[model samples]
Target chain A: MSAMAARSPFRTDGTWLLVGPAVIFLMLFFIYPFGYGFWLSFNPAEGAWSANYQKFFSDEHLWRTLIVTFQLSLPVTILNVGLALPIAFQLRRKTRYQRWVTTLLVIPITLGTVLIAEGMLTYFGPRGWLSQFLQLLHIYDGPIRLTHNFTGVVLSLVISGFPFAFLLTLSYVTGIDPTLARAAATLGAGPWDQFRHIYLPLLAPGLAITFCLAFVQAFSVFPSAVLVGAPSGPTRVISLAAYEAAFEQYDYSMASAVAMIMGFAQLIVVVAVLGLRRGLYRGPVGGGKG
Target chain B: MSAPSERRHWFYSVWSGLLLGLMAFFILNIGLMVAAVVTNSFGRRWLGTWLPEGYTTQWYAAAWKEFQLGDVLWVTAEVVLVVVALSIIIGVPAAYALARRQFRGKQLVMLLFILPLIIPPITYGIPMATVMYQAHLGGTLSGVILSNLVPALPFVILVMTPFIEQIDPTLESAARVFGANTLRIFWHVLIPLLMPGILAASLLVLVRTIAMFELTFLTAGPDSQTLVVALYYAVFAAGVRAPQSVDAMAMVYMAATLVWLLIALRFVNPTQLVSRVKEQPAH
Candidate 1:
């Protein structure tokens, strides 16, 4: 800390002033609420500290929702990252087509969840296009059930999350020094070898960060779940459950407890990610342009 | 070698073709979705076809009349503007300190600011709403605005830090040498250099705020509902046969966001902004 003081002209007072606003803002809105929420988790209404947690664990529906949340998130993360890698690699060609591909990829970020669900209802619903197409081909006797189930929710999550993962990985891939790859080629290395030794190592940190980001995005999913996800099936994510508790039942204390548990789970996961990759923060992948 | 070069050319063409095909598929999907909403808004009926049967603007009229769509739009705009402005105001100075100065627990502070981003909104929304309720701020516009600050503040800080760090500190020192005080130096030298970053941050914040549904939905009551929240209620609540109205409202929301995105892309490079935080290597 003192080392930083020597380089900058700002005195201690001035630096504190500069950083104070952001800290206070985060503390008031983020940390305090988080702390209060955690406290509530321990002290449920009309019970001991562990009582609420015990109830949560005992409830089959709560456990089911948690499992569903994980089921939806894990598959979406894996699928999104898996699918995005090839598109990202191909886009590194830096051709005109690559530019168009990138632009098109950003289109989904603007579409809100409500619109996405509405579109799914019309396009993939029982009487929607897919069902009609299948029926016309004599592949099915009745309408195909795509909505109101796990299939619809997973599809929606994949569609919304794929672009985000793709964009993140694409940027990382392009940032790699092509010179390194060329040098590997000149050294009698093949494409796979070049990728394994040079590209993979550089991409490791980016991949980890992108996975965490994509996972969190999928985990916090609500709109798509409620809109397309069947409440009875394995699609009632923890977020949806928490929302119902807080608003529908007006059980603020219980809702806070649920939220706190989710937050803590996320924090632990992030800590694990950071711990697994020690040298991720070493250098900027893409050097800042002056 | 010549054969390999030819092979590479063939590979490139095939790969490019596939990539473009996927991109076009994605674009077409979004286009179809928008077209459906727009067609539905226009009172067009489509039973079992890709396109609609007929077209009219009566749904939009009905949606407007029934939902007080204009007021919802106003609330969204007002909240987004206030959130963006407040985030920039607080975030810029803090970003400068983080980038330029060394502080104890700096890493911890950075992590703390970024925590909101990692934790899903649902994780925070519940507790935050409870705290608001206790404070009697729940269901108020101010509560919604404050909850938004949780995410928006970190975003502004993360985006602006690199931009501020890029400005050579000597320039500010030079200004000070010319008898300009700290305040003056910041006002004239730093502000001008950071303007583009500020604009880019504002645009990002604006888009985020507009699309924000979960937090607002949880905290806002009927009077404070945003357009997205209103649309959510319209669809899920029982005895509400207003799918057409929902489609119409969604189209309006989509149009507003699309316009903002176009404007953002025109002024700020989306790639640059998205990658700003990742571009900063942790020390």
Candidate 2:
């Protein structure tokens, strides 16, 4: 598409003109507001530049959101990517069930977090079908308490995140040429060895990417945390804390600061995982990696 | 040697079966959860029970009036259509530029397009809302539509770029060589080829903005509320909330989203976006 010799009706300046509108739009709407938020975080309503920062750091309840967010995000990311790996590996090859499973998994992405939370409130709640069925079997003495706690929030994240993780990892895994694995087997490598030496190394970068994405998605836990999880307790993740600060408390300064903190936390993990990709299989995957 | 290999084969089979079983359970649980919400919206008495005692459509009526969903749906339609129209108008040219022309700062531009997608909206939504308030757009239809355009435009660009790239450049050149002008080529030559991509991108924009709870929630006035945001208020707002009414509203949201998604999926693969981002050069 970008070959030097290929001619277009427009000049190079015309090409630049084509790209201008989008960049200008984002600069106005996305970048400017984001910069404004970061700047606003430093100046609070009643104090110096660091007032909101100090307020947040001093208030243990307020600052703990960073930790709570990560606590749930890390596990959810691991579980989603971990579970998605083998399933994607198995379903990478075309099968009768593959398309159906993929579509079923993607049901949540379209369904949205708010709707999933709504569903979980009914099916996973105490005395709901899951609990009642378990009770009928005498598997437990009490109703299955799935909501209003850490379990509920984690379930919500996985329900939404797993499909995402699977879709991304399936693309990554299947992107690799299967002939590499077959070649390894022909050379006396078994499934275990083949996966360890070939698939793991090749899949590392994609896994890192998938993990970061899922983590970011999980870290921004809001509607589900408030709806299904204990928003005042176990699932008071960072986004909820920010929402409370801005809308509930009407402290835009403090809310801006918390939002910056949330972005910073996500950035740290994203940078770390992105760095990990350097040590993975760096050669072009299919051409030379096998 | 043969014995060890045979045992390993046995273990692999068992593990494969376990993995398959886990996927089946995951699918079944989500299916039942969806069924629960759908059924409960109409259930007469589902409290403390595995199944509803009876069902009725009265909740749907109650939900429609109680939530004032008719107006919300209208507002949602307005916001979605404007956002889609704006995103396409802004994004298609950019996609063409990125696909066809080499330039400096292109990588920077690419990264900028993705940042909104990667960084959660809540981080930016609050300040954007504050700006909207300062500018007196916060509680209006324009504000919600503007806030939504931030993500929706870039999304259109990202989806459309690959589509633009896949088109044979020679076709454009052929149209040009045939003396067709820019607008003439775009309308007569490029648009027909680009129609599927444009349709997919715009449909996704519609789906996304409707499901976009955070940005719209932050900026919407009472008169400007979208369905997902309205559903959120129904459950979480301070009052004695009816669980069934909330469920019913959620079903409405679900129906709207599902219909658009089913249509969009007909044109694009779910993995399409992920693969496009992966293929895009970051710098």
Candidate 3:
């Protein structure tokens, strides 16, 4: 295969040129904007180069957005990954129902967060079906205050984030050779033992990556944060702050600062997860020790 | 396989049952939420009821007129199609290279492509929009397209790489042996083999671009808003518009996504929905 690939005129000749456009495009669009934003964050309007950073750190109101965002993202990420891990493990083997379940889950994912927020507003509202159903069943009497609060944002995140977490987790879970589990079983391992001794070690690295991916998605909770969250109160996430800074205040420098801070916060979590993943098994994933 | 003893069987059944119950509850909640939106959109008065007081299509009409659905849909179609076409045009060849060639700094190049996928858009979008504004492209259709391509382009590369890797390079060599040049081998041989992948990437990008909110939201002006962004405005805009009308607009947005989603699902495995991009290594 390697020889064929090398002999093929397509690969040996100016195949490198084929990569040029994408590299140039990403450099122009993705990298340039990132560097530009970093630089712009320092050059604020009406003060020193550190003005935006100084203002952000000094203001309890501004920096508090970080904690609020973490509060929302952390629990949501943990919950999505936590619930998805076992379910994906159980469904790792092919089943007739897996397709239907995945298809159903894809509905919320494709529908996107904006529609979910809209649905949550009406469905979780005081007069919505959930409240009505709860009342009818005498489960609770008062209006369920799920919308326009911290809980609302969390619920919206799970609704959208869980399917994503599940799909990714399922892909990782299924990628493991099933014969590994069968081999473990033959060694008199129970389900829990198989999971703990066999699957978990192999899965540790993938789960860490999954956690980071899900964390990044949860961290940037914008549309749902605004539509379902109280944009001014407890649910005032950092992205919302950045949006306000850019569009409402027309301070691109302040917005850039907030965005940079957001990126920095997310990077901390990703790096930590990846660092931990390095200490895991990291052996052959296809069912061999060597 | 041997039959499990009663105790082990019992334990397994109970555990599976509990997980199934949880999944069922989640699916039910989602179903109800969507039903609530659809019901309210056609409802006369839905206050505290299992169903609406009466059904009518007036809200859809009202939403269409009030939200200017025609223009927003046109913009969304234009943006999504162009992004899909441009990303594929710019991405497939790169994927082919990454698949077939081993080179210096290839790992760095792979990392560059993956960065845009794992990083949250809003974090980068703010600065990207700032750059776009300075370039005099922000608030224009071109700005929206460029911002979205930041993610869509890389996604195309990541997805197509694996698909391209799977095709036997011997075929390309055979085409080369026949004196077909690189471009012809790609055009006549590789493309026909890659149709499934291209279709999958295009349709998934189509659905995603329509649903993509942050980049579009950050750079879009009133004229450039896509359907999802427009739906956000309808919900977020300070106004006295009826809830039903907004729900109606939400339904319109939902219908657009659902149609493409169902079609995309036929071509795309649900497990591949996220494109398995992170784990692929440059060989």
User: Can you list the residue pairs that collide in candidate 3?
Assistant: none
Sorted by lDDT (best first), the order is 3, 2, 1
TM-score of chain A of each: 0.88, 0.92, 0.93
Clashes of 2: 0
- Rank all candidate structures by their TM-score, best first, as comma-separated numbers: 3, 2, 1
- Candidate 3 lDDT, B180-265, residue by residue in tens: 98899999999999998899889888998999999999999999999999999999972579999999999999999999899888
How does each model score on TM-score?
0.91, 0.93, 0.95
What's the interface RMS deviation of candidate 2?
4.2
- Mind giving the per-residue lDDT tens digits that candidate 1 earns over B84-178? 99999988889988888787667888998788866767788888888888888899999888888889899889888988888899998899889
lDDT for model 1, please: 0.76
| lDDT values for all models | 0.76, 0.84, 0.88
lDDT of 3 by residue, A195-262 (tens): 88888888887788899999999999999888899888798999989989988999998999999999
Task: Name the DockQ score for candidate 3.
Answer: 0.60
Q: Identify the leading candidate in terms of TM-score.
A: 3
Q: lDDT tens string, model 2, A1-290? A: 45542555255647767789999988888888889889889989998999988987788788887788889999899999999999898787766688788777767887788888888887888867888888889998697889889999999999999999999999887777777777777678877787788888888877888888888889998888988888887788889888888888988888889988888889999998888677545765434232
- Please list the residue runs of candidate 1 whose C-alpha ends up more than 4 Å from where it truly belongs after superposition: A1-10, A136-141, A188-190, A268-290, B1-23, B272-283
